[model samples]
Target: MQTEYDVIIVGGGLAGLTLAGLLGHQGLECVVIEAGEKIDRVDSVPDDPRALAITHASRNILASFHAWQCLPQDRLACFRGMQVWDENGSGAIAFDSTELGRPTLGYIVEQAVLQTSLEQAVRSLSGISVLHNSRPCDIQWQDDHVSVILDKGENISAHLLVAADGVQSACRAMAGINYRVHDYRQRAVVCVTRTALPHGEIARQRFLTDGPLAFLPMYPDHQCGIVWSTRPAHAEALLKMTEREFNQALQAAFEHTLGEVKESERRSCFPLRRAEAEYYCRERFALIGDAAHSVHPLAGQGANLGLLDAASLAQLILEAGVKGRDIGGRRVLRSYERWRKGENRIVMMTMEGFKYVFENQSSPVPMLRNRALNFANSFIPLKHTIMRYAMGLSGDLPVAAK
Candidate 1:
């Protein structure tokens, strides 16, 4: 293996792999260092309860990296419409693909399935190498290049270092970058359920007193991935309940939107928090994905945002290379930072605002928010604009995302 490359990516997760594949396709030598073992393709369909909402822009970005082609067609669940309502009031908003003259709103894909397909796509690129079960123990940023010292005593050097490690990113810490975090004091309970009635290819979200509850349609007509964000105590209680008891609680929470919750798979829970790096890039080192920023799952947009970050950063790097400019120079790296930071901040703040409004169950706040929802729904042009933004069609997207 080459000890020197054009770029060295820290973290072989979805974002890192996507970046590597894109750069490799552009003929840049890239290496990805992952802490986990290489994951094989999942033979079972829709086995993972954790699902991701792939926006229209995200699909375009994946197709650019050729990862979308690697995904199993049977495992993808495309939702044509969405419905969001408030449980405390009769205010709601609905969106359909036809409103924008599109084929579908977005896709709901299992997390494991997407990652495995991306891995396969990255590995297929001749200029890219994935070093699984290897982690960077030390990093030295020089004037012209960055050196990564791995735990296995291997030394790797690159013109640029990209950190796509998750929220608890070691690279971010090693780079001595500060990040601001806001804890929601809640937990998101996730699982898959088989409802008595079909989902009708529509994603549903109900804003309860605590947080948001989303039922994302999956591959099967009667199965859906449920994300219930609530208080920590409530999430714990839901997890401890038996299958039948949990089903009843879920059904009650959703008000039998899809009839009864007949049965559900195993349950899982994770704390909710949003974090953003103080700086996205400096010198030869740059941050992407959760390492740069992370948001609440209210919109299931964390993954989509990360993918956009990769595409944006990759586009800038490629552009600089074509111009014979130093791809890792501060000028080049800062361009990527400037383009993504504002876009990501807008999304993070939007999710935070939504969470705050939905959680404030007080009398006037709820009434005001409900009215706002209804008013927005009644405004046709505004509703279509919001839908387009949510679908990622009306943004200053990178070429890959476009």
Candidate 2:
């Protein structure tokens, strides 16, 4: 859209759009390069099958930037409690928001709603531009600026370049960053389900031998967005079943915690993997969102982590700008990196640990984890700590999130 900008974000997904809006709001000229069509409020995109558990801190960040209002209020579901258990063990744990003197724990937001709304928010900003279907090629890093060659041969320059692309990020490869990847060897099968009983605004997860199965409350009280993670083979087999047969299997899987599953959509499945870059920043480039790190979906913290990354970087960049410092300088970029990497690493490691403990069937491990879960349930302070962590209310929150 322009030959130059203060910041050029390489993806227009949630992270990229949020950063663009925040930075643009702060008076920085920002541009987002996306490979897809220009999506905004006018786009007739249907509701996405996937929903994210947006922590309270993330909601604060969104509210700070005014993007929260762009989302449809009717489409949001707030969970006041959570129930988790091991299907093969006696360990069961429950958490309630009331313990923390809060009305709700967090919210399950439809992915498409937030993404489109964020894109629209960026578009509304005078200082931010969105270039859709204009793919960037021939990425080159310079000491003072990052140069991007468009497929049509138009060149653009920016003081900072951020890769907010998804897990399989082309920009990450272009920057020559190394990442550690672990395939959980599980596939997540997602679909909308309607049960005989209501979800009661409680998000539930059952640790199966294959993986964890989560039924997140949707906007409708009787329906849920189910993430059924299991081995790839099992996912495929489940996908092949008829709707009735599928509901039976689904009910059997969750042990009908919400009662008989009466209806379900055609299941969609994707492999689960945890990935993290060795370094988040290099020269004039930085990675955020799934491009920087992607964790197992068992915890639903992956997107929340990425959004925090965007907020942290945005705050740092704005602070640097006010000081007349080079936004892409190694020192500046490293500050953003240093601020985010440790917290992200902890989240990734925590997810991996959960994946390991829940996905394994080793007799002793289940009993131990179950005992721990039961013990945790019995301890009010421990449950509060876990709830705080899950709600993104713990740890070092960025300025925007705070």
Could you give candidate 1's per-residue lDDT for residues 1-402 as a string of tens digits?
689999999998878988998899889999999998887765743345788889999999889868899999888999999999999989999999998899899999989889889888999999999999999999999998999999999999999999999899999999999988988899999998999999999999999988899999998899999999999999999999999999999999999999999999999898999999999988899999989998999888898889999999999999899999999999888888899999998898888888888888777998999899999999999999988878888778999888
The pairs that clash in candidate 1 are none
For each candidate, give its TM-score against the true structure. Answer: 0.98, 0.97
Evaluate model 2: give its TM-score.
0.97
Cα lDDT listed for each candidate: 0.91, 0.88
Residue range 6-68, candidate 2, lDDT tens digits: 998988888888889889888889889898886646346554688788999889988887888
Candidate 2 global lDDT: 0.88
Which structure among the candidates has the greatest TM-score?
1
Candidate 2 error regions (>4 Å): none
